[model samples]
Target: MTRMSSFRMSAWGWLAFALVPLIPLPSVAEGAAAAPVLQGETCSVPGLMDQIRRGLASKSPAYQRYLRALLREAAVTLPGAELQAAFERETDPVMAEHLAAALVARSEREADREAMQVVAKRALEDRDPAVRSATVRAMRRTGALEKTGDLYERLMRDASPEVRMEAATNLVEDNKFVYAGQHGPATDTAVAAAAASSDPKATAKILGTLNTEKLGAEAAGTLQGLLRSDSAEVRRSAALALGGVPAEQMGTAREALVSLYRGERDTGVRKALVQGIAQLGFASAVPELQRLKGIDPGMAPEIDAWIRALETGLQEWELILREKQRLQQAP
Candidate 1:
């Protein structure tokens, strides 16, 4: 017989294998097998409250786990009272984190200012970084961060990078509150710290905010320096921000973008620099773009297109300016 045939099970062994399925297995808990299906029903307030209560009251670890899963599934429909009650009753750090996450999800779907405030307070006081991060995320979703500039500024300095990043991003999103009267000093301080942060993501986010808020000229020098950052993302963000610099500052911005482009080796960063240069629409950049075109065979096509676009844009701008001047000089 072949080696494989010799190793195969005999008829009696095969018969035993076939009969194994007929043997009775141990019974599972009464509702354990159906827990997942039952959990889906918890989307109603009463159903969710029942799950929360059972999750809190259960002594069996498996039952508690199933109930918690149910609460998580029904979190979006959970009312403020149940979420608050769950938050108060949960003592396990892990379970507390889950409850906090659930609160965030619920707050996101419904504009529950009071519930969001309660969670925000908890997040501020929580000893756990994960919980704090989750709360910040919740606050972000509810637009609560718009008026909590100071809290976000404090969180920006948190030891947890995740929390700090969350705070940084929220601050940028709600920058109007940060720059508003009386809060301007604190907001500027936070922004300055973010600009100088070692965290590239934080720096990139701030740069993007500056661009979006049309404050690029206000931070022109900082943006220019960030183009040399080790993080390609930050450099790209800086390049895009430079493109938004005010017309009066276009001279310095154009020069900086071209210089960075000439020395940049990263294709992505180079493309961003070209876009910035093209956006600035400086007639002087045409020669620089032509010069850089020969350095990279792959980039030549893109660079040529930018040059053509820039030339067209500059001509249109000149025509508009001349028309304005002629109209001003006319009777």
Candidate 2:
């Protein structure tokens, strides 16, 4: 499927790492009302909270959700004193500000980290394939590469091509070494060829030097076609590649993707449908995706999730419909 460029640095290798933990954990006053929670020991809730708070302060949406989940956990296990200690000891000034703001908004930090972990783990191990696919996506985004590589490799060899397809797609995107021809030789093919090549590095170097612009339009159209391909691998790659299209030409591929979502029977293709729709911000497809639930109710929760993301996902659709009406009424 589509290739993506991944960050060269580790997730923890951020500016916050330099600033936040560098500050010493604050000591309690001689007559403090209560002692700290797990003083001198590794407390998971605080560590998790710090990670999430730093993420939220950086305005990282991915981390914001992660932090929200962690805050939920803190509300459950940590007393206000413990939270205050962790918050007071935060080294990063910017993060400290955000932590203060969030404290004002929330009444109780109510999250069940243990329960969430169990759900995430079970999803990874679920017999229901769709649940597993969703879990894998969530894990990858949240930087939970703990055992993801091994799990992905195993899934690649699974009897169900669907599972293998989703895992491969996620891995390919996460690795950032895969590229579609739009940017030159597709990374998927290059990775495959390199694995079989005598000199994978040289092949990769050659791939790096290719003229990506040469294949631009062809790559866009190819991505559109691949989204509808019966082969799961092709669909996954296409979905990933679709993300790489130049913004100017994104509109060019809209009609083709809309048609695929309406007619394609493959679940992998439909999954790609959600991605492409989000990327292009094709609000017109909202009604179509909404109707698709009649064809398949299982997509309801996901549709609701996507819709709830930005002011209930309604403003965008309403704006699009209003623009259409304006165009229709114009001369």
Candidate 3:
């Protein structure tokens, strides 16, 4: 129902939307809910597990009641294993709103990637769109978005419109910090500093931003340097950034990329670099790609696709651009 083709806010527009004042909700008092009769008879993990074990044994409402209390209190995280076990045993179908939400909420607060991943997997396969939507929002709240990006992207095409919309919103909002840049020396310095200090993967996100005269040159130069970085993530980002650079730099960019790919060893980075070549490199790079494919027959299929993409894609792009220019001149 949710269409991935729906108009998305630009990076700056997303930023502006984010600038709205948010009202902070009141925190739950720890003593708001009486501690469940857990092991050690308290709110600790062992205590919670004891309660869970007892409840699971009896298949009673005690464990479920304990979980509901934990959800209401919102101060502590239930162990993922115990929480999941409780979720599976819930006779009532409200676990999506209660148990799964608790799991994701606690995981987001704890920065627990494993627990978050559990929710992500569930969201993708969950029968209920509401559950899937909540899980997508939780993914947006975690620092684990970089690792779980593929999963989120897959969810953007979810059959449920609500789930797809949630996934799409998160994808746009999550990348705001990276793509929201204007052409200026200050922007250049900020980007350079971020690239140097932050995780290469984070810098990689910025590489996908649209380029301008000043930023394009700076980014092109920075990307070339990153292409040879020790971190494959940096190299991968640099390769992907190839498509957005100024026209004048494409020739040299492709040449340098081809040279880098010749000696590249990381399979993932190699694929990224090949994709980069398809974006910016010319037919001249094909022989080397074919030669490399022969050297690594395992990659022959991938290389053939890249060669086809390079041959076909750019020609089509050129025609499109020419048509656009002609239309502009016609007026």
Which candidate leads in lDDT? 1
Candidate 3 residue 117 Cα shift, in angstroms, is 38
Q: After superposition, how far is residue 112 of candidate 1 from its true place, in Å?
A: 13
lDDT tens digits, residues 1-331, model 3?
A: 2331121123223323333445444447755755543222224434443433445455668756545444523323346677666644443334444555566656656645466667678778877677777656655533434445457546645777676656545543444443343333433443353355334544555454424324556656776777888888778867866644567888778777878887888888888787666655456557767877865566777777656655543555445335434543553
How many residue pairs clash in all the candidates, one count each? 0, 11, 3
lDDT assessment of candidate 1? 0.62
Query: TM-score, each model?
Result: 0.51, 0.32, 0.39
Candidate 2: list runs displaced more than 4 Å.
1-215, 282-288, 310-331
Worst 10 residues of 1 by lDDT: 34-43
Cα lDDT, all candidates: 0.62, 0.45, 0.56
TM-score of 3: 0.39
Model 2 per-residue lDDT tens digits across residues 44-130: 545656566556656577766545544433344445555545544554433443333233223322332233343234334556565
User: What C-alpha lDDT, on a 0 to 100 scale, does residue 145 get in candidate 3?
Assistant: 49
